[model samples]
Target: MQRIFAADIGGTNARFALFTGHEGSLGLDTVVWEKSADLRTAEDLLQIMQRQLQTPLAEGDMLVIALAGPTHGLRGKLTNGPLQVDLGGVGQRYGLSCCLLINDFTAQAFAALTPRGAGAKVVRGRALPDTESTQTKAVFGAGTGLGAASLVCCGGEAGFRHWLAVPSEAGHAPFAFVGAEEHAYQGFLARDLGCDMPTAENVLCGEGLSLLHYYLSGQFYYPAMVGEQVLSHDTPTLHWYARFLGRFCRQWILNTLSRGGLWIAGGIVAKNPQCVEHPAFLQELAAGGDVGGIVHATPILLTTDANSGLWGAARAGLEHLRGQTLAASAKG
Candidate 1:
């Protein structure tokens, strides 16, 4: 029996899914989730999966795990969570054929690579189509932390679409300020968080939303509570949050030069304005100085799918299978 086992592990939660079928197309077998806090280690997570799914991982299965932090080979430490895992060992323990540990955003780039509503436009304006055979795109998610990555593609056959996925730690970089408001807020963040030169993740993630809301409204509210107001587009706090996010997006787009478009995922974006044609957020996405025109030309899309990361993990599994087949054929 053959199967694909994938996990999307973030700071707060771990989502697992099993799939059956070929690389390009996969069918879901079972999916389960566990809180990272509850699970002390990666092995604990697997045990929970076995119990919840009513199935144990078996031999010849393919495994892919996406983490919120940077990854090296099949082992790495989670930047936001407490698990330091050797994903390859997990596979070997179960007599699996292959295993991979990848950055969470790396998986996200694959989601954008797949067609069929993987992304929805959040800002008004048509994305400049990929006129060049080879083009670049950016995908970033804001959650427990800000995760970023780059994708390069030279348009061609489905199986031959030469593309590269590069992971980034852009959120840890110093935050760039566009105006006095941002500068003051930066100081406030540093003071409150007790950090020096706060990073973009400080304001772009869920916790950042709460801080931003408190800074503006002087009323403290948790990130979880801010979601409803953001969805309804009913409060100044969300407006400010949107503006701040727009600035962050512009910075990343410029940094990566993702002309193919920018696709944003995670908590905030998942609840962004209903349609790209009319986004309450990112109103000034195209408003930076000098390069303002350039930013306007870059398209921005948002995904409402709560399971986007999981979808990307599944795609990761498919690509892994695809790569193995190609390698074997070449050797033969």
Candidate 2:
């Protein structure tokens, strides 16, 4: 049996977990979440997690951290927080067998493979065809910012033989708006953002949620507060937010051609499933013009499992360990 330590480090929170067992059958042993801001000036999160662990770290255990931003090889810096991660240095400092770093959304993509992501509420389309096994699936969500990633599976009914998680910085891309009203709202966001055009993150995140509420109601409130209003009342803000999310998801689906499906994960949609459940959301998602049939055929699911990122990181760690064992066997 192999041991793995996995972390899902976001802008606001950092989650750590320990998993045991080989690839395809890992079990969670322990998990904890800490405020990322608390460790901004202190020791790195790995050290803190190590000390908090009931079972002390053992040599040869692998570590995999999923960061909230793009990664270059085994290192990445969080886009919305203060953390410059270097997996190689982490491995050296912690005396681990291997260390890996991946984009947080890529972790979500991998999570789609595990049972934790199963039984998702289908908000927009039908379930994947039974014959479908080898295809691409995508996941995106809005939180501190927007994130996206895709998973490429290769195999058949027997089961997937390989999986690849493709990370993206697509959130930074400019968002398109239709109609004069939307254009005016876009201008408002652009001016507020100090950019000529508003990116998806500027209009789809928590700040965006608050900004949208203010745009419609002329009153500023926290995301949670706005979420409460949206959940309780059928306000215009809810419809607009749902439309924007639907449009964004549609664009992502078209860009990735993820016919296998698109899974939505993030605090916004996960906490308030009604966001996607709203008719406006599906209307916008299915509004692909000539390609409406294609959009209609693609499955849409909402990921409600909060620990999905941790599970994804653990899955990644197991794959790393498997690769190492394979390499050693080939050499011997």
Q: Specify the highest-lDDT model's number.
A: 2
**What tens-digit string does per-residue lDDT give for candidate 1 at 45-85?**
67776677677777336777888776789777777767887
Candidate-wise lDDT, in order: 0.71, 0.79
Quote the lDDT for 36 in model 2. 83
Q: What's the CA RMSD of model 2 in angstroms?
A: 2.6
Each prediction's TM-score against the native? 0.83, 0.90
User: lDDT score, residue 177, model 1?
Assistant: 68
What is the lDDT, from 0 to 100, of the residue 321 in candidate 2? 71
- lDDT (Cα, 0-100) at 49 in candidate 2: 74
Supply candidate 1's per-residue lDDT for 14.
Answer: 86
Q: Candidate 2 on 1-332: residue-level lDDT in tens?
A: 88888888887888888888653576888888888875542137777778656555554388788888768887788877888876665565667767888888888987776666555667766653332356688899888778898988644224334677888878889998989999999989988878998889888889989999999989998988888876556789989988998899889988888888888987788878888878888889867563646676788888887789988888777666766776698899
